[model samples]
Target: MEATQILDVARDGILTMVIIAAPVLLAGLTVGLIISLFQTLTQIQEMTLVFVPKIIIVYMAVLILLPFMIQQLVELTERLMDLAISLP
Candidate 1:
């Protein structure tokens, strides 16, 4: 592949990765922020408070977003395969 084509592929791969990861990461980030706020407001400084909820929420987010994530991956794979087939 030409350098430009290779760069395009790399960029697409990265963007796809970010798209797939964004939801779960955002979910965890949001939960952590909200829980942190709650902890600060209520003064209930439980060590496990931040972790457990984030884990559960992130997991739930992944479950909910699985189809979309898989579809993105499949699209990426299709693009990669098409590129490969077009290559000399």
Candidate 2:
């Protein structure tokens, strides 16, 4: 592959990864922030309190987003394969 083509593929892969991960990451961040706020207000600083809800919410977000993530990955793979087949 040409340098530009390689770079394009890499960029696309990274972008796809970030797009796929964003929902779960954002959900985790939101849950953590809310828990932190609650802890601050209540003067409760249990570490598990912060971790458990974030993990559950992020897992739920991942489950909800799994289909879309799979579609994006399949599309990216198909495009890369097509590019490879067309390459000299």
Best by lDDT: 1
lDDT tens string, model 2, 7-87? 999999999999999888999999999999999999997888988888889889989999999999999999999999999
Q: Where's the lowest-lDDT run of ten residues in candidate 2? A: 45-54
Per-residue lDDT tens digits for candidate 1, residues 1-88, read 7999989999999999999999899999999999999999999989898998998999999999999999999999999999999989
lDDT of 1 at 7: 96
Model 2 gets an lDDT of: 0.93
Instruction: Please list the C-alpha lDDT of all candidates, in the order they appear.
Output: 0.94, 0.93
- Runs in model 2 deviating more than 4 A are none
Model 1 spans with C-alpha error above 4 angstroms: none
